[model samples]
Target: MTAEIGPPKSANPEIVRRYARLLREHGDAFNVTDNQTAIVRMSSFASALICLQEGAEPIMQMTCRDRNRIALQSDLLGASALGVRNVLCLSGDHQTFGNQREAKNVYDIDSTQELQMFKMMRDERRILGDDELEEGPKMFLGAVENPFADPFEFRVARLAKKVSAGADFVQTQAVFDMERFERWMSAARDRGLDRKVHIIAGVVPLKSLGAANYMKKKVPGMIVPDHIIERMRKATDAKSEGIRICVEQIEHLMTIKGVHGVHIMAVNWEEKVPEIVEKANLHPRPPP
Candidate 1:
């Protein structure tokens, strides 16, 4: 669920509630944002709690760029107290990339350290400094993996490090280069990571030629192929064609042995997800 507020503040209740309603109606878990792309959006936890009230399961996104270790740990506890179970930990985009470019960056602890802290609280029933908890919070830990990141050879190694640090699952960056993604998946399987973690491939259907171009040229750690861009350029109905491309990608992903699931991130386009899911025949999701 992409709740891009389009420069609006969080006080606009509709921004959160409307997306929450969409998630509930579609029976899809919501992924509320925490200043994604370094833009100041609604607090991820706030959106998550709103979605929870609307009867949708939410995955709160946390980043290390803004909060220190103490704040992170406190927020985790607060999130748990508010009934949040799943979390996606990220190192976060740099502050200079967002509207608040002048704001100081606070990467007091890196993502790996944050992952370890989460693991400590959830698995070992302890937090940083090794204080014991009579009962630990039940959390479904998740992390981000950018297969398109530079030094591609090290991508899998980074993923492995996250898993070792205590990630239960990984939601990768938006994938458009299927060939590259296949190679990455092969590496993941070869390294036996498929057995250790649930890997959810991210898919963001192109809305237009402009969106495709923006992704290819602007987004960091993203890989959009030239052919996809050309196809969008020539297509009369770019939006429909984008959905077709995404469906094809989902179909291909289903055949890959190590792939566990597809995380469709149709930003601010939640309305299109049900169509994509239906076209991909993902209805009546399998039992756990």
Candidate 2:
């Protein structure tokens, strides 16, 4: 499983270490988000290094929203020198949603282009402008997709494009609508996209009725079915019910084709991850 962890707002090494240790105990690799939601936080690179020091593998997420191509390339070189192996390229959330509304966004290149650059850097030992490097970043590249997004027929096609662009693996947005996810997976399998890349499905445990509602109505590119919301509403202990539902989802996800693994995103309720993993019988994670 890939555990998603956000760095704290300030430089708090101890907090990072605590969460990294927790996730490493129950997860194969923990993902350090890059300024998630376009809000500022500790840099993903520093938090990832803390994870590495704590003996945990990190999937460092890099977004195109904040950095230019020159900075992106420089960061990649630094990450490689520092032994950060896994990288997930993303077109991040808009600055409007973030606290720093005045920030000027940069989309120097989209996520697909970034993936191509990473592939070239690794396979060809060349950066942009055809400049040769003494050594390229030996990275296991990743990308993200939203199967729940509209224009549903195109989701799998988009995934195929990312694979063609050199994504070694792809993690999808949270799956609240399983039927849609199943259909998407079926299409992916038909296109043999699953064989080309590892597909890690996303699953989030709803912490409250309000949280469910926000995702259902507020979050763009999110599709939370009415049934899920109703489940959250009718539950007595929403948190416990949420965890149970998440465990069930993970179990059900295992039976689906083309689902390589699950990314359990317990946002702020991260301490509950071990319980979820144990209840789902995914504990005793294999070694790195």
Candidate 3:
């Protein structure tokens, strides 16, 4: 399984290194967030470099929200120079939701276009302007998909678009509604999208009932089932209950045909990752 970790709000390499070392014990890769929620933080590139320094494989996330094509390309080239090999492309959260509302958004290209650009840079050794590169970034491309989103039937088609644009792997939005996630997976398999790319299911280990409620009500593309909330509500130890639920989700995801792996997004509860990984029988990951 993989684990997604966010950088500190300000500059703090030690914190990033600590998380990287802790998570690397059980996860195959560490996915560093790129100004997630559109809120400013340490750059994903720097955090990913910290992961690398901590002896972990870093899946650096890139968003099209803050930078134009030229700037994005420059960052990718920098990543190449730094030896970071994995990247997750995203359209990112809107600027209005972030602290910098006055900041002009630069979505010169959407996520799919970003993927195409990165893929071209890697495969064809070229940039957006078709300029030849002495050595293009050799990256394993990834994209995000929210199966819980509305117009559910079109989610798989959306994933297909990313695959066609050259996403090597796909990490889904956190899975709380198993029924819907399974249905989406089934559809992806039906269209043979699963065959084209590795699908890593996302799971969040809730810390309390309040977190569950918040996710259910506030998160735009998330769907937290009432049953899960009720379970959390009745649990005497909410944190442990959340871990149990996350482990169960990981186990269940393994049974799904198209799921290649699980992405544990423990958020602030990063220390519990090893416990959850062991409980889910994903510990001592196979050697690369």
Candidate 4:
């Protein structure tokens, strides 16, 4: 029989501990952010606390855009110490999308390098040069993919590289165009990547007309159909309609074969996750 894999752990330490306890008690998957802005703003920590409180396993995302090598290593160390066993490393969103325009951008290490660093820490129990008495964090490293990005070939190549770099799993960008996403997944599988990594589809719920428009105009590669937009416009309450649309979209994606799981980008709409899970019938897999 195939071994059953639980949901990825959250990167936030506090959430890690909470989810660790949850998995120990009741098993449920809780998701969290990897964006620097969210981390700095303490939303990452806050969500981690929620995961712990609810006894839910969390999948934490870590990005390279906010911290230098030293800071990044420090955070990783802290997370491991706090029992954070899963990490989704990312290069992070560009500075322009964030609040601090004047702040310096730190790309000291990209996601692939970060994954390699995590692998080294797990295998060596210490950084490459520093041989110290440290218990390395055992992290399930994950990466992100933007199937809609230009030069589709390049995106696939980068994904293969990330898997080679040490990524155990991958979560894709918000998937609006299912056909395009399926094509990318097919190509990835043909490249021998599908067998190596567990791919979780990313789903973000549209909150308002403005939100839809911003994603379409500002967030490159996120394409929402005109029909979805029209539905949002016709709804009596935009927020309610947005949630309904999210549920519908998630349900549709869940039916597609080859998708391991759905990573919902609630974006502060945490309360709605349980609803989506129920609507999609996503239950915790039995432990092996």
Q: How much lDDT does each candidate structure score?
A: 0.83, 0.93, 0.93, 0.68
lDDT of 1 by residue, 33-139 (tens): 78887888778878788778877778888899999998998899889988999888999999989899999888999888888899999888898888887778777
Tens digits of lDDT, candidate 2, 6-78: 8999877998899988878899888899999989999999999999999889999999999989999899989
TM-score of each: 0.94, 0.99, 0.98, 0.81
Ranking by TM-score: 2, 3, 1, 4
Instruction: Report the lDDT of model 3 for residue 263.
Output: 94
Worst 10 residues of 3 by lDDT: 279-288
Clashing residue pairs in candidate 2 are none
Ranking by lDDT: 3, 2, 1, 4
Candidate 4 Cα lDDT to native? 0.68
State the local distance difference test value for candidate 1. Answer: 0.83
Off by over 4 Å in 1: 1-8, 25-28, 286-288
List, residue by residue over 102-130, the lDDT tens digit for candidate 3.
99999999999999999999999999878
| lDDT of prediction 2 | 0.93
